[model samples]
Target chain A: MAVRLYAASVLALDDCLLSVMDIPGVLDALVMDHLSGTVMASGGRGEAERSAPALGETLRVTMDALAGATHRGTVRIDDLIVIADDGYHLLHPVEMPFDGPLVIYVRLDLGRANLALARHQLSSITGRLRG
Target chain B: MAAVHTLLTGLAREHATGSLNVPPAGKAYLREGRIAHLECPRTPSVERLLTAHGRAGGYSRAELEFCVAGAVLDAAYFLLPAELPAARPKFRPGECPRPDTRLEFELAWLVGECARRRAQLAQIWSSAELDDVPVTPAARLPGHRATVSALEWEILLSSDRVATPAELADRLGQPAYSVLLAVRRLAAAGLLVAPLMPRRRGRALDRAVPPALPQSDPNVLAAVKRALEELE
Candidate 1:
């Protein structure tokens, strides 16, 4: 049955999210629907409820503004990084073949997070999650 | 309804696993008291929204989870605000809807999300009346060049001035709330025909009604009597 198959998928996604949380200094991680700003999966923090829409709105506004500035009809965003005083926020967008795009949001502690290393690992995890 | 919310909260407390059937709206599927899925007639189901457009078959694990989350939220937005019907909500112990999904949400969290979504739509547009009426595009854009989202573009193209946002949502295979939000944004952008002003009730008669007079002063009573006479 489809339900049985879906349960396996859920476990896989949860494991994938666990890997996201394992990245050093990550305060939280969320998989967000780009179109509607829904939080698909969340781990490592309790703020996913509040963060999903705010971060999603930020990404949407940025995407729209950047696309306008470029005079391009459609713009593809790879990663959006925001460095705050207390933390680092990374939004990586993945385009799905059959559904609306998904954005992976991770909040990292400024003192403990390595910007370069976190980005590299996130990219690898995203590649696997996408497939 | 508040009763529905209370029922869900109670169910969560007991760690009840079953479906809560709210007729004329839809049902909520629970796993260990957490909401696993929700379906509402006003919104698209996960299967309908994702697979109905001939894009069926071979969804990645991530994609399935993503769709379920989106669909659950969408259905909750429509279902949670409804008034409880005369028929009491039935709880079928250990009953699972077909194609059960793994995405689960805390009851409190889901309710808060629905409230948040309601507040969002209210902030974007002042009225819910527009949601049910046919979406009518303006004769011209508010300006020569205005920014529009991809969904907005689709809505504009699909708006025949006949289909309401709900109907268009079903036809376009998009979540009903998303379509409603986009329509509201279009209205805010001056891209849709303005809705007619709601008719005001008779105010003169309302003002003419006398206030409670059991303990009123005689002078105030005289004024009230005179005012009542003037209406005649």
Candidate 2:
């Protein structure tokens, strides 16, 4: 994608979060700040709000680990897909201007989810959010 | 706070509407027994962070509120925890925090998040001792070069050697957790000098906290190393 400075989105993040959750196999979605684990918006059955800090901590550690392995100053991770006891927990990180490294956490149903298509669609949504 | 954790929760339970103040430290604004906003002088505001990082271009109201939500949690991580000897913050009921940014949330949930954050810090370093003790960057970039994230770069650039990670956070107008993460990461990467010599034994000890080795897992490191080589 060509880099163009996007005019900040006027869309309410809550609505954006809700729209993301409507995707097939997407059980829930929460937009959270990675730095402080603050839940900006949640659209799940509702684990996203509570797991904000833990998830943020996870992202911090993961970033450190990735940087170590890559020997890079910073690691730009688009998403992290973790398999859980019930299904899949997909964390999509969106870089926002006002705040974040905002992460969009999505719970996907393994049985019905298309990982590639979902990721592509998520990329699209995040792209629209970028500044 | 008489009961510390319970005080805030209990206040919320009773539908108390006021700001919990920890003077010279931070404040938590409660609206009708629920957490609405938080501000810490030690922890920079979202506006400050956005301005510092040059990411604040034209923030809309929703975007700013989104930032405030993150700011509230970021401050909560430092201010919410049931106090420790290292950074003991005693709160007394005080006036409401001004310029209220209304976003209602349960205090209990925030406390839970604080617990997880405490554990997360331990996961980074066995203890919070290094957090208060000043850290000095290596005279030379260990390997004559270094890779640092935006936060890490700010940390390295502003590391006075006299100011600890907490102090640096305040100085740089960044979140305490983010700065601490950078501090630990720098230590892990061997880009920072260890804070071994304790100047003061005032409660928080400077114990030997081993840095997480990048090469600990041969398999993962090897794959990444190979990928880097391939790119080269």
Candidate 3:
């Protein structure tokens, strides 16, 4: 009701963010444009926002490097993971048909987060977000 | 910007609240004079700060304020005035918009942010001709040697030529700002036939894009620096 009054159209992608937030161990999550690193939407802590610039650049550089290294015209990445002593940081690249690839990144506490479940949920969120 | 925008900005600066309606453009919603919301039927809502200025967690309060500030400022640049011939587009004493809803907010920060964003957009691609123009993908990959980002690839594949960036954004359910950036980047890359003049009419709000948030622990100080830097 408030949504109709406030925002003519309430953002639906926010649902996707909420779904990811419900996953256990997920501390922070954000989605950024793959090319310009523009923040699209997010939930959790948003600790990953600043890294968006570097993250988007990393996606570009890595895509180029991998394509060249493997000698392929196109290269597809499933996801990128960084393991830390304190927690786990995951970057999932979504092949959204609209703006190309938007990266959905999440940070998880190593102690509280189940890597398998978290990855599974992240993948699920990405799929649902695109559909 | 248009005259209706100036009138609307004045209402915001004076701490007035309501919806400043523009016949053909869009509406600006002010909360206690601080622009609380914006509605342009033809343009995508900067619903969540999706500008090219920053990158960060999109869920923090302060960050959210910054996002709000950006949305207000960016809209002012395009809608708050008739045309910005002077380098600095400020809110001079003039006509403003009369809105139906009102809230409380200081417009000082909003004013400054507008200037900053204006300078920033100029630095990005330095042209607005293509900003509102309809865009179409190139016939074939030029030289077939173009190096593009993932987002660019998506935009290229989706460009049907008839859709403007705003329309494309609506179709893809992506932020209009990101689509705006993608269009600029693609044009800069020489991958599109720009000057495809024609502003798309208003679209229904069936598929609205999502907002931006950052990923961090809830226990931190909200490292405002990271988010601001990416956007600033």
Best-fitting candidate, measured by DockQ?
2
Clashing pairs in 2: A73-B147, A73-B148
Prediction RMSDs, each to the true structure:
17.8, 12.7, 13.0
Score each candidate by Cα lDDT.
0.70, 0.62, 0.54
Best by TM-score: 1
Can you give the TM-score per candidate against the true fold?
0.77, 0.68, 0.51
Could you give candidate 3's per-residue lDDT for residues B105-147 as a string of tens digits? 2344444434644554565677766665557777776775777
Residue B39 displacement in candidate 1 (angstroms):
1.6
Instruction: Summarize candidate 2's per-residue lDDT along B113-206 as a digit string, tens digits.
Output: 6676666666666744466677877777667655566777778888767777756665565666768766776776777776667558642223
Q: What docking grade does candidate 2 earn?
A: incorrect
Candidates, ranked, DockQ: 2, 1, 3
lDDT by residue (A1-131, candidate 3, tens digit) is 01011121123345556677778987777755464354545665455655666766666677777776776767888877779885787888875323336577778888999998998988877665534
Instruction: Write candidate 1's Cα lDDT for A1-131 as tens digits.
Output: 00111122345456667778889999878866676665556776567546677888898889878877886757778899999885899999887632367788888999999999999999999888656
TM-score of chain A of each: 0.86, 0.83, 0.80
Model 2 ranges with Cα > 4 A deviation: A1-13, A35-75, A79-90, A107-117, A127-131, B1-4, B54-57, B82-96, B140-148, B195-232
Cα-based lDDT at residue B25, candidate 3: 47
